[model samples]
Target: MKYLLRYQLINYLRTYKYVPPFSIFILIMVVNYTFVPNPILNSYSFTSIMLFFLMGWFTITLFHAEDEGQKIITILHSKGQSAYYGSLFIVCIAIGFCLSMVSVIYPILIGAFGEQPRVLHIIMGFLSHFSLAVLAIALSAIFTRELVKNRQNTWWGVLSILIIAVAIVTLKSVILPVKGLIWLFPPLHLALEMMSSDDSLKNIPYVFYWQFAWIVIYSMLLIGLYFFILHHKRKL
Candidate 1:
């Protein structure tokens, strides 16, 4: 597993697919610092949106890397599907954590943010952003794997426009309870509520506990489904 992870990480570094997302993250930070007196506030406000897209793109690219003929051949010769998926999962989580730290740690380091620094707030923000990125990657992996199984190419442009439109249109509506459906997506619920509140630390325990639990549940579910798909496809 370690060797496979190292090989995959080196491949990602060589391909430069990770560059665009990190570049965008840096750009967002620069713009936030330039225009906003409170860069941390801007980062907190935008982290959900930024990470949603960035991690999605990153996951898509990583999954597609397997589609190349040479890479597929390498995977077959290695420890096979288990090692491949495990290594990919580790890489995705690492990328998510690194990208999330830009929003969490950079703000604290600069000391130009909103309220006086609270340890609880920082911890909660970091966990929430990281979990959100993981969720995005998990969803992307499922989508990519299904596309591969069905022998269909991704239409990223169309999917991007649709996602943006739905997010914008439902941003406010998602807050309102619709038959308790809001609880179904814990990450989105927590992110929206957290970003909306000026005093996020007040209810930190409740939000943090639920978000953490949901992230674990969601990730396991998606990953399990991904392997199930792979198994079924192999049988066919």
Candidate 2:
């Protein structure tokens, strides 16, 4: 298990497919803090959205990091589908964890906050960023090569879903009749919505409880469906 995880990590790094997403994240972080003394949660709200997109991009590249031949070889040597896919999932989540930490701590190091950031603010920033990262990964998982035969379409499919999911709040306001239908998408906006209110920040843990729980359940379903399809196709 340990070696398989390490193998996946090393393969991802050696491919350098991580470069663009990693570079873009750092570049945006610098730009995000260019105008100093930004409002804390507001600043966090914006970057968490950025992390959402980047994590989606990050997941795609990592998924394709190993070429078809190498992936087949890894699968043959591994214990089973569970170990292969499970290790990949863990590696992706681990990368998301690192990015989340950077998102929360970078602004503080640069002194970008309008006021002294409280412990609560720091916690919210990390949770928002990390939760979005996980959600993006789960959404992107179903759109990978196993199901999405066309490489180009897979990329656009993931992008379109992310855009629509994030834009649900706007869509709901514009299309009142189908608001219930629009709400079927993942509640990514809910993660950002609470952070927008000052009062919500006072009860950080309570405010995020449902949103966080929903994200967990939503992510698991998407990912489980993805694995089921991938496994079924491989068997066939």
- Choose the strongest candidate by TM-score: 2
The best candidate in terms of lDDT: 2
lDDT of 2 at 59: 88
Candidate 2, residues 1-236: lDDT per residue as tens digits?
A: 99999999998999989999899999999998998888988888888899899988888888888889988899899998789888888898999999999999988988988788888888778888888899999998778787899999999999999998887867666655764664467878778886786723555667477787787688888889888888889889
lDDT of 1: 0.67
Candidate 1 displacement at residue 11 in angstroms: 0.7
How many clashes (backbone N, Cα, C below 3 Å) per candidate? 0, 0
Using all chains and alpha carbons, the TM-scores for the candidates as numbered come to: 0.83, 0.93
Model 2: CA > 4 A from native:
174-183, 205-207
lDDT of 2 at 159: 96
What's the C-alpha lDDT at position 188 in model 2? 87
The residue ranges of model 1 lying beyond 4 angstroms of the native Cα positions read 39-42, 149-153, 157-186, 200-203
Candidate 2 overall Cα lDDT vs. reference? 0.85
